[model samples]
Target: MTPPPAPAAAPDPAPGWLVPGALVLRLMLVAALAVALSGSVAAWLVTRASGQEAMRRMVSQQTDEVEVVARLLASKIEQSQKVLRTVAAGITPGMLESPSSLEWLLQQGLPAVQFFDTMQVARDNGELRLSLRAGQLEKAADLDPTERDALRRTLVDGKPLVSELITGRTGEARVMFTMPLHREDGTVMGVVAGALRLQSQSLLPPSMTLPARDDSQLIVFTRDGTILSHSDPTRVLGQVRDEVGLAPVYTRWQSQAQPVVGRGMTHVQSDHIVSMAGMPLPQWIVARVSQSQALLAPLRGAQREAWWLAVASMALCMLLAVALMGWMAQPLAQLTFKARQLLKTSTRQRPETEMHWPQAGGEVGDLVRVFQGLVQQGSLQQSRKDTVVGQFQAVLDSATVGIVITRHGMLEVVSHQACVMLGYTAQELQGRPSRTVYASDADYAQVGDRVRAEVAAHGAFDGDICFLRKDGTPVWARVQGRGVRPEEVHGGTVWILEDITAAREAQVQKSWGRMHDALTQLYNRAAFDERLGQLMTERSARQRAPALEEEGGEAQGDGVVLFLDLDHFTVVNDIAGHDAGDDVLRHVARLLVSHVRQIGWAARLGGDEFAVVLPGCALARGQAVAEQLRAAVRAWEPSYQGRSFTLGVSIGLVVLDASLQDVPSVLYAADMACYDAKRAGRNRVETRHARDVSVTSSGRMALGPV
Candidate 1:
């Protein structure tokens, strides 16, 4: 009555289909597991690799920053050394005799040093001199014997020595550098010493900032394990500790001459240590990066969330695989047909392919939405091209450069900037040939040839050219031009011009100033040489002229060279500033110009020196003219700063004939005569004929006139 053992289930159709179906389901499950495992493994491996790479990059960047800081420190050290050398050079034996010179050296030299606490000059005779911001102070006596001996050692070596950290009179911790002062013959004269404070900020990198963590620190120590400077000045300065944990690291750095980087596990205070050596100075700079609760707090939370998300993702992938397998088991032929149909539709139009993903509230639906958004974006791009082009045009027009367009050597279109720079209206410039603005036909042709050559060689031209303005004045412009087809140009060749007249003028003036003295604004040495050559050639030609013989003269054109030097010019320059001296020079130039206007060339040679060249003037006539110039300068009085000052000029005259071919020799003779006039007395004129001078041991001259 138990229901006859529930009718032993009938052995239905062949089990082959069911076996393959079950096998397919198991295979699908294994494949999904494999994919998820592979993905997770790949993600973890990539993350680890990325983290290691990031760590290496961070370390490399830190090392580079450290190197930069070290280089800056080395520069400061070099600067200090130069300053010490300069101070030593300024203290000479002559300087010691003059107290004012000593004071001037202290006032000028001390302020010039960039990073110094004090400057002291100590003589070998136990005399100590100190310069500070307040004023100069002389010590009561020489320093103690020990200090004097130490200084003498530094002086004998002629090298700078870094001293141990010691407190100054101002109660500031500082280190001193002593450099020796040597004579021209390499004899030790004195010692020049400079002090630098050893505060936390003194030696530290200007860009360095203390880490936010309270336990983090930046420590700087000498090579011999002595603390020099630290982020916490109060804690490290003048306090020497064993620094046991850091000694080995320091030794490794010294041997390798490189940075040491590692994590300090047991120290609780510092979890990471980075140390490097400073160049030129025997010092080790170390930065300690510590582990802080505040920094690690948020990381723990992020790690927890990352683990949960990874696990959830793996489970979700497995469930999706199982569902997909189950659905595929029902109808393989239908799925294949559907996939082929979708592919064919997608080939013809992309819009239809967007609907291929399942859109019925699942992961596949979200992916389908993303793909659809991408297709929509692609459809919208073409509509924005015109706007972008308009913006580009706006940027071009707003640029400050002047733009001009030319076609076949004729102006086509000119921008507003071009009209403003060239002093031409836009309408006036249009359709005009380039020659209308270029001033000269020769210049226009030269420009055209250069343009063609530039385009042939380099495809463009960039340089400065002078252009004529509408008013017939020249304007300098930095111009760049390129050749283009008529169609590409919208008519012509395009050019950009930048007005650089002011800068060009400034450069020219600077070059002029270098060759000529500022006060006299005269020919200077270089200009005099050029003018003298021209005069010599003219005199040579004139000597062969037939008119000289016809006139029954000496048959030789006479040339006179006179050298004029201002006496008491220094007194004027010292009493009045250089501005007043310039005024006097201008007045003297005008006087010389007026006197030599008839038959000669006059030039202010340089400073208070002047020169004159007269053709067809006899020796007597030249002496008379020289005397007149001397009288003018002697009688002149100039008022400066509400005071009147009288000055005189000394003149040296030399007459040259056709036979004398030595120009420099004549000039030297004239200069020597002027020197003699200066030595004889002020306000006198001396004349030396070229034929009458002879070489003698005494160099005694036979004077002809007063």
Candidate 2:
């Protein structure tokens, strides 16, 4: 019948390549990413700091430019104030009373002082009596209220005062420097003032020398945030706070006790630098407003270059990862192929010479060396296996005993003696079940169980067992064996079988001779002593017998010993020689055997003297057995050498019991009774019971029972 199909196995999971391949790739990528991220962050920090430094430098440079412009303007105002004071020292009340003389004095003095837009000498009522315009003398007019207040302050303090920025009649921003004119007696007289036009390019530094960018500006504003003049002409004269971007900066500058330098917003940048310095005169603030982005342009360029370099590094990492993957996989693939080929070659019966495989350096080279070692080891092992097998076979054949190796209860290898002993060729025994050599299933199972037990306890076995030869005759074999490993005898068991058939038969014959007589082939006297002693020992021990119980009650001892003496057996030896005497002894032995067969043990003590022991028998039964043996001997007729003679036996019987000390005592009692029977009549039988009063350790004769 076809076997049932096996259950389908679950599919194996897919080979796990992601971990090995992706691990290298991911490691490289992660390292590169970490480096890139760190580099980018570091570059950003460096660039940000550089940008701030650039801004600081720019602010410093711009502030210096604004300060230079303010100083120039302040110097011009101071020089005009000094010139007015000197002219005032010359002008007396007389010069003030004559407008013509005052005009002439102002024109001559103002012409000597540069940067004076207009020069005037005014009375205490703030009316300019005479003035110089563009270096020409003109009639003076009353000053406006703002100009009067500044002239009044100048007269009251008797010192020079710088006026707030004002618009000229021509729509230009200007500042006036005013001083009180004093009389020779130290009395305040009129005011001398000069106005400098700030809008005129000459009042400010040259545009080319300014550090401010196109998007930047330099402005001079009042403490109240009023615009005075700006580098950008369009923003000149406008309120500083009116420009929304500059409001906060203007407020901060106004509150500051010293020059303020910080970032602020402007039209160009929401956050730009505003550096403010307070001018000495008019308390005006000179501020340099610079765009932050414009100042950091160089830093940005450097940052862009850093980002491009990072991108290039990432591309290089990709190329290296690809190259490393191939470099790693190729050597392993070659090693795998070579290893497989080596395995295939190693399995063949006759392998070729050692393989020379491809090699690489480093760890791959070490692996190649290991593979070479393995191949060489395999070759050495093969050669060793061949030598070992040859040596094993030589050892097996040389052994005196037959050795057989069995696997799974089948003979795998058989020695020459084993084959010869079984009367079969080596091929016939190989692969055959070990049971095939057993005489019977019982013998096979019996030997197997015993051998297994021996092997389990000692790793070896030895015993005698019966086996069948090829001709179906049984042979006694002495077997010794051992297993290769515990509980794995089925894997391999080495057995040595020595045929002991002839030796066993000889042993049996030797044993038979030691206990039996050569003349009658009956048990000898020594055997009789042994048998009778054993029987008496059993009877004394009270061993019960079923037969004796069924027949009648057992005496204290239930064994019987009989002694028989041949009647007139000397007459045959005298007439027909010792050969005829041997014939008579043989006839008597057979007669005793026929009468007492299976009843008990019988043995010939010596020439013409014999004894029998009946176990579990009462005295009455032993007496009846002795009479039968006497009658059989009397009835026997022997004819030897054509001569006829009749022979009879004198018999004596004794019952074995507790009173008998041992076999020797029983024999003495029976021997004495036999002599009594011979004395009374040669062929008659006499009986003695074990409890007879005369029987004792010291005496042999017993007349009657107790």
Candidate 3:
């Protein structure tokens, strides 16, 4: 039958894979997944950190490069100022008085002005005293206002000064550095100035920028977003906001209030790494911009390699996890196999070598030992179970009597002896009706009813009952039974049966033997006396007898007792040493029985004495039978062991009538008559009636316990 489905509220079963596979496989899978997940996360963190670090280093390097370029520009301005001061030191008040002498001195000093575009001595009125241009001394009619401003600023502060970008006399962008020409008393005589042109590469260092072939650019721009220097000469002097790479950087600097005192990396534009450093005096910015991909190329390569290494490590760790899980699960597998094998085997005691268990020392090993102990305990229990079953069977086999157990009138168990008794096999008896062994249905019902009633009352029943054997013969049995649960209406009953048919027959034969004499096979004295008492009781009860069927059809008379004494029996005993006496007595008993065998029965009262009972004989007929018994006894010639002897019998007869109250009264009259005959003369017949009181005087011969 199919089972009902589980309720919806019940928890679902585990996945299909969990039931059959080895534990190690599952553990290994989990471990591998953990390793892979952890490795992926760790690799991501490391790669991201590597990228950030590379960007940091790239930004720092870019800042340093820009700063160095800015420093180069400042150094060039300082060199120009040094030249102006040198020229001012060479001037004196006397040399400045004459243009010819000043020209001569200027021509001599011009040799050292190779780093400058022009060197000139200016007057207090801002007129050029003398000038050196292209290695020649010349005089200019109009000086550039930037140079005049430097001269005036230098004379006023008594210190050298450098001017910002200005149009020089040559109509080119230039910066002029001027120094005060002082007198001996510290009065300013005039100013000496040097101008450096900015239209060419003279102001830039040879290696002032990164390689132009790359996408990286270096620009020196003012904090107000004007490009002072750039890798593209045409882009120089252009607005920084208009440059694609510099647009966001300029905007960022503007947002920070254009402070010219910091350097850092910032993401002003996507895909770009820009570093900026402040320049002196001009508030100019030396900014470097590079595509992030290019700037971080080495770091990316390292990250790729690191990621590959992480993947390889994850694989190696998973492999180790699988190996370790397999190693750990080995003991559990053995224990499982051992537990399963126990079911497939029949015998309790398996060979020691049949199973090999792990001896590891953790919980799994302890579990293995526990399983072993259970298996050993099971084996012991199995052994004990087999022994108990065997002992029970042996007890049944040797019981030697029928043992039948019935449950609800059905044979549930039949022992070997029970089978033998019923001539059926145990298998044939089992499950069969209990009535099959009974002589009849009534007998079966009787046994059942008795068992139910008696067992409930006293727990047991015993009686002799007839059971049918296989051949349908009745077998009398002494059946003893008990109920297992008599309070239940149809409870089981156990019966033990012993065959008593032979015993009953033997008892009957013993009863017959007790009533007869062994020697003559006649009724013994006690039996004869009992028969006389019955007849006497019948007479005293005044009961009449029906007419006897006879040859003459004569009316039947009252019963008569004939008592005989064997005469000369002592003479034979004295002559034949009692052997002859016994022969004589047997001979006489045979004679008496033979004479009365047709009408009555004979009994030996004791030694040398005999009696006959004629149930319907008259007194005359009894005397006549007595006389015939005396003649037969007198005719007897006895012999013993070949010696010859003769014996005679004296007879007395008495009528049994209502006058005789009991058996002893009848026996007494008969014995007295027999004594009278023996006293009158041996071998004579004497008759006495029940009313013949004169014939009584004899010693009391009482009957026994009868």
Candidate 4:
């Protein structure tokens, strides 16, 4: 009846077996999780290490490249200096002493070196007596006195000296290097100087290639903190100090003999480290490398792989979940395949998918609902990207100023305003070489050469260039160009051209107005002084050219300068209003212009003072012109507001000879002649022949005053 005691209560159903099985499943899950986590962590560590190594390699390579460039630049500069010294040493002491011989020497020496823009020889007395053949003898007065003194000191000290960047006659930055000229007896004779344009061809190589990175910048500076060359020389030249946040790095590099690398404290968001190398000329070549997100190409690929792996693991988990439900696996597999197909299709074409659930499904329906939400989000993101691109295009098209885009030297896009400014339809400019439509042949060639050179030297170029319009007239444009590979560009370089002709013209006119007199529209005293220096140079040069015999048996190589002053002009202004005085001035200026137009240049020196520059004119012709000017002024009648007035001119003429060396002496002689004319009597003409010689004025001759 016990019935085996109910099988002894089934031995408590072996609770130990159930517990051990559960524990075994839990341990497998934990082991798998630990293996996955460890794999992920190890992969992350490897990726981090690889990234660091790659960066280090890149930095080292960039540093080496920078050093090579610095050495090349230093070698070029040194070679140029040596060539100039050789030329200077060849000149004899007699050649250095004589203006004509020195000019001859320069004419022969300058063209030998391609980099020299102007070669000059001057005495210790600050007289620029000679210039090279390619030189324009204009505005010798532009030379700074301090610079001249420095050159003179170098010559006296028997040494070479390089000057800081200075502006030349053409308003371009140039570096002047001077060498001393010595006699056989070791006496200082003169100084030979060569002016090199920083933009000259030999300073840079024909081409340069940048690494596959965008956020890196390169800068070159002289030992004295002078930016000798740069990718954008115009922007960086003469802009001293670390104002652009590169100063601390530059200072540290210049102060230290070894290379220094550190993060820029001023710009923290940018993980920028500066590496600098030095050249023989005391220049510190610097390269700044920033840890840009775009440079993380390997990391980006790893992240994409990680994401896909996660997606695959999630899909497998979902499949396992469905299998546990005891439903027909085929239908669920079909549903999953359909969802995957829809996702793939949406990714390939457009992010819009219509997903439906099978009728025999509970889990299938839930899976479809989740996938549908993902599709909706993908569609929303696509729409946002499309909208942003469209808005950007619209803004660019509707901009106010003319915008032109060029790729690989060919025009790609032209805004409406750009089309109008260039006098071309957009279609006409499309696919055509930018030079074909806008730049002249010579200018285009120059620009093309410059572009190539810049790409080789600095990897980019940005500045103003004069572009010819469709009408064949030149228009100033701010042209900015950067080198790009196929990935950066649609496949070519990105060049931007902006019409800045109006602004440039305005600036030119403003500068002209500042340098000219308002009343007479003539050069003011400052301009006059400048011209006087140039005229003196011409006078000296003319005295050296082959002499020509005139029909009257006279040599006519000498130049005469006449400085004239109006007699009793203040009295006329007191009697008649300034308006009438202006009329009188106008009449006098007309007379002077008409009388001296053929043989001389006339400028209104100031109120009641005028200067007449008679080139290649002898003392007799100068005196005759002065007499005619006096007669014309005396006979002239100025009418203003129904009133008439008359004025007379007193002329003081100074004839410069081969002996005259300084401008001040000629000016003093003319001023002395003017004083003599005034003291003798008003309305008379006087001439001073030489520095100490005085002239007798014609007696007070009167034509009735109005």
Top TM-score: which candidate number?
3
The TM-score between candidate 1 and the true structure equals 0.37
TM-score of each: 0.37, 0.39, 0.43, 0.37
Name the 10 consecutive residues with the lowest summed lDDT in model 2.
Answer: 260-269
Model 4 bad stretches (over 4 Å)? 1-22, 123-128, 137-140, 168-170, 184-188, 204-214, 223-228, 232-234, 238-248, 251-270, 282-291, 297-299, 306-706
Q: On a 0 to 100 scale, what is the lDDT of residue 606 in model 3?
A: 79
Candidate 3 ranges beyond 4 A from true positions: 1-24, 135-142, 167-171, 199-202, 205-207, 258-269, 305-309, 337-706
Superposed model 1: Cα runs more than 4 Å off: 1-36, 97-104, 107-110, 113-115, 124-150, 167-171, 200-216, 238-248, 251-270, 282-305, 324-706
Q: If both were scored by TM-score, which would come out higher, candidate 2 or candidate 3?
A: 3
* Model 1, span 599-674: residue lDDT tens: 6767666668788878777777888888998988888999888999989988888777654555565666777778
Please give, for residues 169-277, the per-residue lDDT of candidate 2 as tens digits: 5665667778787776876888877777775554543462355457677777777777766666666667887764567766664576544332222222456767666
The lDDT for every candidate, in the order shown, is 0.64, 0.72, 0.73, 0.65
In the predicted model 1, the residue pairs found to clash are 406-492, 406-493, 407-492
Clashes of 3: 0
Q: Residue 180, candidate 3: how far off, in angstroms?
A: 1.5
In candidate 2, stretches whose alpha carbon ends up further than 4 angstroms from where it belongs are 1-26, 92-94, 113-115, 123-129, 135-142, 168-172, 183-187, 201-213, 252-269, 294-302, 317-706
In the order shown, what is each candidate's alpha-carbon RMSD?
29.4, 48.7, 57.3, 34.7
lDDT: worst 10-residue window of model 4: 9-18
